[model samples]
Target: MSLHPRRTGWRFQWVTILWLTAVWVLLWGDVSWGNVVNGALLGVLVTTGLRMTPVDFHGRVHPAALAVLLGRFALDLVRASFEVSLVALRPRYTPRGAVICVQLRSHSDLYLTLTAELVSLVPGSIIVEAHRLTGRLYVHVLDVETSGGIEKARQNVLDQEARVLRALGSDAELAEAGLSRSRRAREVAAR
Candidate 1:
Protein backbone atom coordinates (compact mmCIF):
# COMPACT_ATOMS: atom_id res chain seq x y z
CA MET A 1 0.00 0.00 0.00
CA SER A 2 1.05 3.56 -0.64
CA LEU A 3 1.94 5.84 2.25
CA HIS A 4 -0.95 8.02 1.31
CA PRO A 5 -3.79 6.92 -0.88
CA ARG A 6 -5.04 8.94 -3.80
CA ARG A 7 -8.43 10.35 -2.99
CA THR A 8 -10.85 11.89 -5.44
CA GLY A 9 -12.94 13.89 -3.01
CA TRP A 10 -11.03 15.82 -0.31
CA ARG A 11 -7.49 14.65 -1.19
CA PHE A 12 -6.48 15.29 2.38
CA GLN A 13 -3.11 14.08 3.66
CA TRP A 14 -3.14 14.02 7.42
CA VAL A 15 0.55 13.28 7.92
CA THR A 16 1.65 16.07 5.68
CA ILE A 17 -0.81 18.39 7.32
CA LEU A 18 0.51 17.58 10.81
CA TRP A 19 4.13 17.84 9.72
CA LEU A 20 3.56 21.20 8.06
CA THR A 21 1.54 22.44 11.01
CA ALA A 22 4.29 21.45 13.43
CA VAL A 23 6.84 23.27 11.31
CA TRP A 24 4.60 26.32 11.22
CA VAL A 25 4.17 26.32 15.00
CA LEU A 26 7.89 25.85 15.60
CA LEU A 27 8.73 28.64 13.19
CA TRP A 28 6.39 30.90 15.07
CA GLY A 29 7.97 29.82 18.42
CA ASP A 30 4.56 29.42 20.00
CA VAL A 31 2.33 26.51 21.04
CA SER A 32 -0.98 28.27 21.41
CA TRP A 33 -4.24 27.02 19.93
CA GLY A 34 -4.36 30.10 17.69
CA ASN A 35 -0.99 29.16 16.21
CA VAL A 36 -2.05 25.54 15.89
CA VAL A 37 -5.32 26.39 14.10
CA ASN A 38 -3.57 28.85 11.82
CA GLY A 39 -0.82 26.39 11.10
CA ALA A 40 -3.31 23.66 10.26
CA LEU A 41 -5.16 26.04 7.95
CA LEU A 42 -1.93 26.95 6.19
CA GLY A 43 -0.96 23.33 6.02
CA VAL A 44 -4.23 22.45 4.32
CA LEU A 45 -3.90 25.36 1.89
CA VAL A 46 -0.35 24.40 0.92
CA THR A 47 -1.15 20.72 0.46
CA THR A 48 -4.16 21.52 -1.68
CA GLY A 49 -2.38 24.19 -3.71
CA LEU A 50 0.82 22.38 -4.60
CA ARG A 51 2.04 19.01 -5.65
CA MET A 52 3.94 17.00 -3.03
CA THR A 53 6.08 13.96 -3.42
CA PRO A 54 4.93 10.83 -1.57
CA VAL A 55 7.33 9.75 1.14
CA ASP A 56 7.71 6.03 1.71
CA PHE A 57 7.05 5.01 5.27
CA HIS A 58 5.83 1.75 6.83
CA GLY A 59 7.08 1.93 10.38
CA ARG A 60 5.70 1.52 13.86
CA VAL A 61 6.24 4.12 16.52
CA HIS A 62 8.42 3.18 19.50
CA PRO A 63 7.04 5.36 22.23
CA ALA A 64 9.90 4.70 24.64
CA ALA A 65 12.53 5.50 22.06
CA LEU A 66 10.52 8.49 20.90
CA ALA A 67 10.42 9.86 24.43
CA VAL A 68 14.17 9.34 24.79
CA LEU A 69 14.79 11.18 21.52
CA LEU A 70 12.75 14.18 22.65
CA GLY A 71 14.25 14.29 26.12
CA ARG A 72 17.79 14.11 24.78
CA PHE A 73 16.94 16.82 22.27
CA ALA A 74 15.86 19.21 25.02
CA LEU A 75 19.03 18.57 27.02
CA ASP A 76 21.18 19.00 23.94
CA LEU A 77 19.46 22.29 23.17
CA VAL A 78 20.24 23.74 26.56
CA ARG A 79 23.81 22.47 26.56
CA ALA A 80 24.52 23.74 23.07
CA SER A 81 23.02 27.10 23.94
CA PHE A 82 25.26 27.50 26.94
CA GLU A 83 28.35 26.37 25.06
CA VAL A 84 27.71 28.72 22.17
CA SER A 85 27.15 31.57 24.55
CA LEU A 86 30.48 30.84 26.19
CA VAL A 87 32.23 30.81 22.84
CA ALA A 88 30.64 34.12 21.91
CA LEU A 89 31.53 35.74 25.22
CA ARG A 90 35.16 34.72 25.15
CA PRO A 91 36.98 37.53 23.42
CA ARG A 92 40.37 35.84 23.47
CA TYR A 93 39.30 32.66 21.76
CA THR A 94 39.10 32.20 18.01
CA PRO A 95 36.60 29.67 16.78
CA ARG A 96 37.74 27.05 14.29
CA GLY A 97 35.05 26.36 11.75
CA ALA A 98 34.83 23.41 9.44
CA VAL A 99 32.29 21.93 7.01
CA ILE A 100 32.20 18.17 7.29
CA CYS A 101 30.13 15.66 5.37
CA VAL A 102 28.49 12.87 7.36
CA GLN A 103 27.27 9.74 5.67
CA LEU A 104 24.07 8.57 7.33
CA ARG A 105 23.23 4.90 7.80
CA SER A 106 19.64 5.19 6.59
CA HIS A 107 19.11 5.80 2.88
CA SER A 108 15.62 7.14 3.43
CA ASP A 109 15.17 10.84 2.78
CA LEU A 110 12.88 11.03 5.79
CA TYR A 111 15.60 10.10 8.31
CA LEU A 112 18.18 12.23 6.56
CA THR A 113 15.94 15.28 6.65
CA LEU A 114 14.90 14.65 10.25
CA THR A 115 18.50 14.30 11.43
CA ALA A 116 19.54 17.40 9.50
CA GLU A 117 16.69 19.46 10.96
CA LEU A 118 17.33 18.28 14.51
CA VAL A 119 21.06 18.86 14.24
CA SER A 120 20.51 22.31 12.78
CA LEU A 121 18.19 23.32 15.63
CA VAL A 122 20.99 23.09 18.18
CA PRO A 123 23.50 25.92 18.44
CA GLY A 124 26.94 26.11 16.75
CA SER A 125 26.09 23.81 13.88
CA ILE A 126 24.13 24.31 10.66
CA ILE A 127 23.37 22.03 7.78
CA VAL A 128 25.24 23.38 4.76
CA GLU A 129 23.96 20.94 2.19
CA ALA A 130 22.23 17.58 1.91
CA HIS A 131 22.56 15.06 -0.93
CA ARG A 132 19.33 13.11 -1.10
CA LEU A 133 20.75 10.22 -3.10
CA THR A 134 23.95 9.87 -1.10
CA GLY A 135 22.40 10.24 2.35
CA ARG A 136 25.15 12.68 3.25
CA LEU A 137 24.83 16.00 5.00
CA TYR A 138 27.43 18.76 4.84
CA VAL A 139 27.37 20.51 8.17
CA HIS A 140 29.16 23.68 9.24
CA VAL A 141 30.36 23.77 12.79
CA LEU A 142 31.03 27.22 14.25
CA ASP A 143 33.75 25.83 16.54
CA VAL A 144 35.36 22.46 16.59
CA GLU A 145 36.43 22.84 20.21
CA THR A 146 32.96 23.82 21.29
CA SER A 147 31.45 20.76 19.60
CA GLY A 148 34.13 18.37 20.89
CA GLY A 149 36.03 17.36 17.70
CA ILE A 150 35.50 16.63 14.02
CA GLU A 151 34.96 12.93 14.60
CA LYS A 152 32.67 13.58 17.54
CA ALA A 153 30.66 16.04 15.49
CA ARG A 154 30.15 13.47 12.76
CA GLN A 155 29.17 10.89 15.37
CA ASN A 156 26.70 13.35 16.83
CA VAL A 157 24.81 13.59 13.54
CA LEU A 158 24.77 9.82 13.18
CA ASP A 159 23.56 9.49 16.76
CA GLN A 160 20.74 11.88 16.00
CA GLU A 161 19.77 9.73 13.00
CA ALA A 162 19.85 6.62 15.15
CA ARG A 163 17.54 8.27 17.64
CA VAL A 164 15.11 9.19 14.90
CA LEU A 165 15.10 5.72 13.38
CA ARG A 166 14.78 4.00 16.72
CA ALA A 167 11.82 6.20 17.51
CA LEU A 168 9.91 5.73 14.25
CA GLY A 169 11.38 2.87 12.24
CA SER A 170 9.98 -0.64 12.08
CA ASP A 171 11.93 -3.80 12.82
CA ALA A 172 12.69 -4.28 9.12
CA GLU A 173 13.74 -0.68 8.71
CA LEU A 174 15.96 -0.94 11.76
CA ALA A 175 17.59 -4.10 10.50
CA GLU A 176 18.15 -2.47 7.13
CA ALA A 177 20.16 0.16 8.97
CA GLY A 178 22.04 -2.55 10.90
CA LEU A 179 20.09 -1.83 14.06
CA SER A 180 18.21 -4.41 16.12
CA ARG A 181 15.65 -4.33 18.90
CA SER A 182 18.22 -4.52 21.66
CA ARG A 183 20.04 -2.09 23.94
CA ARG A 184 23.34 -3.24 22.49
CA ALA A 185 22.03 -2.55 19.01
CA ARG A 186 20.98 0.97 19.85
CA GLU A 187 24.32 1.63 21.52
CA VAL A 188 26.23 0.28 18.54
CA ALA A 189 24.09 2.16 16.05
CA ALA A 190 24.53 5.45 17.87
CA ARG A 191 28.27 5.14 17.48
Candidate 2:
Protein backbone atom coordinates (compact mmCIF):
# COMPACT_ATOMS: atom_id res chain seq x y z
CA MET A 1 0.00 0.00 0.00
CA SER A 2 1.10 3.55 -0.69
CA LEU A 3 2.03 5.77 2.24
CA HIS A 4 0.47 9.02 1.06
CA PRO A 5 -2.98 8.29 -0.36
CA ARG A 6 -4.94 10.73 -2.46
CA ARG A 7 -7.69 12.60 -0.71
CA THR A 8 -11.17 11.60 -1.89
CA GLY A 9 -13.23 14.63 -0.92
CA TRP A 10 -12.73 17.26 1.81
CA ARG A 11 -9.88 15.27 3.24
CA PHE A 12 -7.12 17.61 4.42
CA GLN A 13 -3.63 17.29 5.82
CA TRP A 14 -4.48 17.15 9.48
CA VAL A 15 -0.92 16.37 10.57
CA THR A 16 0.37 19.41 8.73
CA ILE A 17 -2.34 21.52 10.22
CA LEU A 18 -1.55 20.37 13.76
CA TRP A 19 2.18 20.85 13.28
CA LEU A 20 1.66 24.37 11.90
CA THR A 21 -0.71 25.23 14.69
CA ALA A 22 1.80 24.07 17.28
CA VAL A 23 4.55 26.06 15.64
CA TRP A 24 2.36 29.11 15.47
CA VAL A 25 1.41 28.86 19.11
CA LEU A 26 5.06 28.51 20.07
CA LEU A 27 6.07 31.45 17.93
CA TRP A 28 3.33 33.68 19.31
CA GLY A 29 4.01 32.52 22.90
CA ASP A 30 0.30 32.07 23.45
CA VAL A 31 -2.43 29.59 22.63
CA SER A 32 -5.49 31.64 21.87
CA TRP A 33 -8.45 30.59 19.72
CA GLY A 34 -7.54 33.32 17.24
CA ASN A 35 -3.98 32.03 16.97
CA VAL A 36 -5.20 28.49 16.41
CA VAL A 37 -7.68 29.58 13.75
CA ASN A 38 -5.01 31.63 12.00
CA GLY A 39 -2.52 28.78 12.17
CA ALA A 40 -5.05 26.34 10.75
CA LEU A 41 -5.80 28.71 7.91
CA LEU A 42 -2.12 29.23 7.28
CA GLY A 43 -1.50 25.49 7.27
CA VAL A 44 -4.31 24.90 4.79
CA LEU A 45 -3.05 27.62 2.49
CA VAL A 46 0.59 26.53 2.62
CA THR A 47 -0.15 22.84 2.12
CA THR A 48 -2.55 23.41 -0.72
CA GLY A 49 -1.18 26.51 -2.49
CA LEU A 50 2.55 25.92 -2.05
CA ARG A 51 2.20 22.27 -2.93
CA MET A 52 5.30 20.19 -3.15
CA THR A 53 5.45 16.69 -4.54
CA PRO A 54 4.45 14.20 -1.90
CA VAL A 55 7.09 11.84 -0.60
CA ASP A 56 6.77 8.28 -1.82
CA PHE A 57 6.79 5.84 1.07
CA HIS A 58 6.18 2.10 1.05
CA GLY A 59 7.23 1.06 4.54
CA ARG A 60 4.95 -0.69 6.99
CA VAL A 61 4.84 -0.02 10.72
CA HIS A 62 5.54 -2.96 13.03
CA PRO A 63 4.49 -2.15 16.57
CA ALA A 64 6.55 -4.92 18.17
CA ALA A 65 9.68 -3.78 16.38
CA LEU A 66 8.98 -0.19 17.36
CA ALA A 67 8.66 -1.21 21.00
CA VAL A 68 11.96 -3.04 20.87
CA LEU A 69 13.68 -0.12 19.17
CA LEU A 70 12.42 2.30 21.78
CA GLY A 71 13.58 0.00 24.59
CA ARG A 72 17.04 -0.24 23.07
CA PHE A 73 17.20 3.50 22.58
CA ALA A 74 16.39 4.13 26.23
CA LEU A 75 19.11 1.75 27.34
CA ASP A 76 21.63 3.24 24.95
CA LEU A 77 20.69 6.72 26.11
CA VAL A 78 21.50 5.88 29.74
CA ARG A 79 24.73 4.10 28.84
CA ALA A 80 25.89 6.96 26.67
CA SER A 81 25.04 9.52 29.32
CA PHE A 82 27.27 7.67 31.82
CA GLU A 83 30.07 7.26 29.33
CA VAL A 84 30.02 10.97 28.45
CA SER A 85 29.88 11.90 32.12
CA LEU A 86 32.92 9.75 32.81
CA VAL A 87 34.85 11.43 30.03
CA ALA A 88 33.85 14.88 31.25
CA LEU A 89 34.82 14.13 34.85
CA ARG A 90 38.27 12.83 34.04
CA PRO A 91 41.23 15.20 34.32
CA ARG A 92 43.30 15.84 31.22
CA TYR A 93 40.90 13.77 29.21
CA THR A 94 41.27 14.33 25.51
CA PRO A 95 38.52 12.82 23.41
CA ARG A 96 39.74 10.03 21.18
CA GLY A 97 37.41 10.87 18.35
CA ALA A 98 37.25 10.52 14.59
CA VAL A 99 34.85 11.16 11.76
CA ILE A 100 33.50 7.81 10.67
CA CYS A 101 31.50 7.38 7.48
CA VAL A 102 28.40 5.19 7.37
CA GLN A 103 26.53 4.36 4.21
CA LEU A 104 22.79 3.85 4.51
CA ARG A 105 20.98 1.06 2.71
CA SER A 106 17.69 2.82 2.10
CA HIS A 107 17.54 5.78 -0.28
CA SER A 108 14.38 7.27 1.16
CA ASP A 109 14.76 10.86 2.30
CA LEU A 110 12.47 10.21 5.26
CA TYR A 111 14.61 7.33 6.53
CA LEU A 112 17.81 9.25 6.02
CA THR A 113 16.56 12.29 7.88
CA LEU A 114 15.12 10.28 10.75
CA THR A 115 18.25 8.17 11.12
CA ALA A 116 20.51 11.21 11.14
CA GLU A 117 18.35 12.98 13.69
CA LEU A 118 18.08 9.91 15.90
CA VAL A 119 21.82 9.19 15.78
CA SER A 120 22.69 12.80 16.50
CA LEU A 121 20.33 12.84 19.46
CA VAL A 122 22.31 10.03 21.08
CA PRO A 123 25.28 11.09 23.22
CA GLY A 124 28.95 10.40 22.24
CA SER A 125 28.25 10.80 18.53
CA ILE A 126 26.86 13.41 16.15
CA ILE A 127 26.30 13.52 12.41
CA VAL A 128 28.86 15.98 11.05
CA GLU A 129 27.43 15.89 7.58
CA ALA A 130 25.06 13.91 5.40
CA HIS A 131 25.34 13.32 1.67
CA ARG A 132 21.92 13.44 0.08
CA LEU A 133 22.78 11.64 -3.14
CA THR A 134 24.93 8.97 -1.56
CA GLY A 135 22.89 8.54 1.61
CA ARG A 136 26.08 8.57 3.61
CA LEU A 137 26.61 10.15 7.01
CA TYR A 138 29.89 11.32 8.46
CA VAL A 139 29.48 10.92 12.19
CA HIS A 140 31.89 12.37 14.73
CA VAL A 141 32.25 9.70 17.37
CA LEU A 142 33.63 10.30 20.85
CA ASP A 143 36.00 7.35 20.72
CA VAL A 144 37.93 5.76 17.91
CA GLU A 145 40.99 4.24 19.48
CA THR A 146 41.89 1.86 16.70
CA SER A 147 40.58 0.08 13.61
CA GLY A 148 38.46 -2.00 15.94
CA GLY A 149 36.67 1.11 17.19
CA ILE A 150 35.89 2.11 13.62
CA GLU A 151 34.45 -1.32 12.93
CA LYS A 152 32.40 -1.09 16.11
CA ALA A 153 31.05 2.29 15.09
CA ARG A 154 30.20 1.03 11.64
CA GLN A 155 28.44 -2.00 13.06
CA ASN A 156 26.56 0.25 15.49
CA VAL A 157 25.25 2.31 12.62
CA LEU A 158 24.19 -0.82 10.76
CA ASP A 159 22.47 -2.14 13.85
CA GLN A 160 20.64 1.11 14.35
CA GLU A 161 19.53 1.06 10.75
CA ALA A 162 18.29 -2.50 11.03
CA ARG A 163 16.27 -1.69 14.12
CA VAL A 164 14.77 1.37 12.48
CA LEU A 165 13.88 -0.60 9.39
CA ARG A 166 12.26 -3.35 11.35
CA ALA A 167 10.27 -0.80 13.28
CA LEU A 168 9.07 1.21 10.31
CA GLY A 169 9.98 -0.59 7.10
CA SER A 170 8.25 -3.28 5.10
CA ASP A 171 9.88 -6.62 4.30
CA ALA A 172 10.73 -5.28 0.89
CA GLU A 173 12.37 -2.24 2.45
CA LEU A 174 14.30 -4.49 4.83
CA ALA A 175 15.70 -6.39 1.86
CA GLU A 176 16.34 -3.16 -0.01
CA ALA A 177 18.23 -1.78 3.00
CA GLY A 178 20.60 -4.80 2.80
CA LEU A 179 20.53 -5.92 6.38
CA SER A 180 22.68 -8.96 7.16
CA ARG A 181 21.23 -12.43 6.84
CA SER A 182 21.73 -12.98 10.53
CA ARG A 183 19.85 -9.80 11.41
CA ARG A 184 17.14 -10.59 8.90
CA ALA A 185 16.85 -14.09 10.34
CA ARG A 186 16.45 -12.63 13.79
CA GLU A 187 13.43 -10.67 12.64
CA VAL A 188 11.73 -13.87 11.59
CA ALA A 189 12.71 -15.51 14.84
CA ALA A 190 11.17 -12.54 16.64
CA ARG A 191 7.82 -13.17 15.00
Best by lDDT: 1
lDDT of 2 by residue, 57-76 (tens): 57767888888888988887
Q: Which ten-residue region of model 2 has the weakest summed lDDT? A: 1-10
lDDT of 1 at 168: 90
lDDT (Cα, 0-100) at 111 in candidate 1:
85
RMSD of each: 4.2, 4.3
Q: Model 1, 1-191: lDDT tens per residue?
A: 44543542243377778999999999999999999999999988887777666666668789999999999999999999999999999989999999999999899988888999999999999999999999999999999988889999999998899899999998888899887766986688789
Residue 95 miss distance in model 1 (angstroms): 0.5
- Which runs in model 1 stand beyond 4 Å of their true positions? 2-45, 184-191
lDDT of 2 at 43: 82
Candidate 1: C-alpha RMSD to true structure equals 4.2
Give residue 188's error in model 2 in angstroms: 6.6
Q: Lowest summed lDDT over 10 consecutive residues: which window, candidate 1?
A: 3-12
TM-scores, one per candidate: 0.79, 0.77
